[model samples]
Target: MDIIDLGMGNPDGATPQPVVEAAIAAIQNPANHGYPPFMGTASFRHSITAWYQHRYGVALDPEGEALPLLGSKEGLTHLALAYVNPGDLVLVPSPAYPAHFRGPMIAGARIHNLILKPENDWLIDLAAIPDAVAEAAKILYFNYPSNPTAATAPRGVFPGDCRLCPQVRDSVGS
Candidate 1:
């Protein structure tokens, strides 16, 4: 019998040659053996800032704003710890990456799941959220190229379209 396995979302192929080579080179460097800086290296932060500026024509301060995390999971959790207060409401789309909800969970925030419908191209219906919930929500989480669903938000879905719901205080996009 043939069985299909689908739990982990790891890529099915080997790491690309360039990425593998870079990782190997980094590991071989004696300077990289020690524990990394808490906020990431200055060079990495600078690179990120430069990349953002180049890609989006937006300027970011490398020293103050560009933080490099080990991964999105750790970053999200830390963000939750920093921003969420106990009993605060967090709006998360359903069928989301586990970390999106887990971070808020660890922060003791109450999660209000917004169901992503196929009809809406997996986008949450912000209007469907009750006025009370929307008003009380501290954070609204969104993801493009969504895990599991692989849904991508249409252009102008954020900032432009999001302004329609003004009650939401903060939003985190992944």
Candidate 2:
């Protein structure tokens, strides 16, 4: 018998030498030893804001809008906690990363799984969702270069012509 493990998303390769070296140096710095700020150091947030501005031409306030998280899972969880309310509907892509669903679950939000079908290039078929569910949804979670499925949304499919129902207050994409 042969075994092939595919459930985990760990990288197949080692970290780049420069990146590892940089991490080691940062860890060794005396200035880096203290507990980090709750929302991350100002420098980290500023760097994130700057990257967004450079990559997407979007300006974000470092102090108010930008936050550095341990990882996307934690970020998504916090986002759910911040926006989701009990009885609120959360639209999530089916076959999504576990945290996408878990966050809303922890927030007591109703989970509305949007099926990502292969016929639609693994994108959610908005039309398939019931109008009531769509109208009640408060948050929509999407991930491009999606985990497990490895699906990529076409250009303009997100943050473009996509017209989520008016009730949607937050759309998180990673």
Candidate 3:
């Protein structure tokens, strides 16, 4: 039998053998059936922080900074609902995954779309953002290896003071 996954970005292929074996093993274990902690398991959080430290040399506290979510869409939705108020300005890149802007829209935020241009290799032109807009924006959603466009920004693209933006949430590898 063949299976076709016509779902959102799912690969048209069989499940990897190792992953399938792992799933079978987990399903057979009673401990794996229960719900996990809301903040995720300590080991998972520790692993996340450790990955950050190794990959980017950034130190993060597992208990305080690391959060393991089911997926990016769900997490971003909750984040927007929790932080953004009605009419608050949010900066979202144009031609992005719906989740990038949908959450803010649902929160009644005023979205300012950052246009990605082929001339700029689809990267957001940080310098072009007006001073007033930058200052007024409540949150900026940035994605690299961007959805649809496949754009990637170089390291150090963000300014030291975050280019005067108050909150920047980067959704990498989306």
Candidate 4:
């Protein structure tokens, strides 16, 4: 029997040698033998901050605005956990990825699925979410380079901070 590998829609790429060596070194270090900081190590955190600064030209405060996580997927679920209380409405797009559903499901959340038809170029009309659902919704799960469908939405689809809605964690690969 052939075993089908149905991923939770995660990227599959080899860790670069340099990154692997660094992880090895950190593991070998006696200082790292203990529990790691909840936020993460200063070196990695600084590296992340530097990336955002260099790419976006925005200096992030590592202490407040930035904290490193094990992975973006885990961080996203944790975001749902932090903000989405039970019975809170989570707005997700139709024909979506699993985590976009699962995260809120595990958080005991109800979804207000926003259908995205091809005619609209896969962008949601903010006006479409039912007035009651919009008022109740706590978080919106979305993807830009959409999974399964591979549709790319417009930049102005969501508001100023909507960039983060599907910003860092929604990528998928083989």
Which candidate leads in lDDT? 3
lDDT of 2 by residue, 44-159 (tens): 99999999998877799999998777788898988999999988999998888888989899999999888888889888777777878877888888778887688887655644
TM values, all candidates: 0.80, 0.80, 0.79, 0.67
Sort every candidate by lDDT, greatest first: 3, 1, 2, 4
Give the Cα-based TM-score of candidate 3 against the true structure. 0.79
Candidate 3: tens digits of C-alpha lDDT, residues 9-96: 5466799999999999999999899899999999999999999999967899999999999898898888999999999999998877
Compose the digit string of candidate 4's lDDT tens values, residues 1-174. 864334466546688899999999988989768877888778778888899988867798877778877765787788888888889889988877776777888899998888888887776667666677776777877777876467887655566433334443232211
Q: Which ranges of candidate 2 are over 4 A from the true structure? A: 1-8, 12-18, 158-161, 165-174
**Backbone clashes, candidate 4:** 0
- Model 1: what TM-score? 0.80
Worst 10 residues of 2 by lDDT: 165-174
Q: In every candidate, how many clashes are there?
A: 0, 0, 0, 0
The C-alpha lDDT values of all candidates are 0.81, 0.81, 0.82, 0.74
lDDT of 1 by residue, 73-92 (tens): 88888889899999999999
Preferred candidate (TM-score higher): 2 or 4: 2
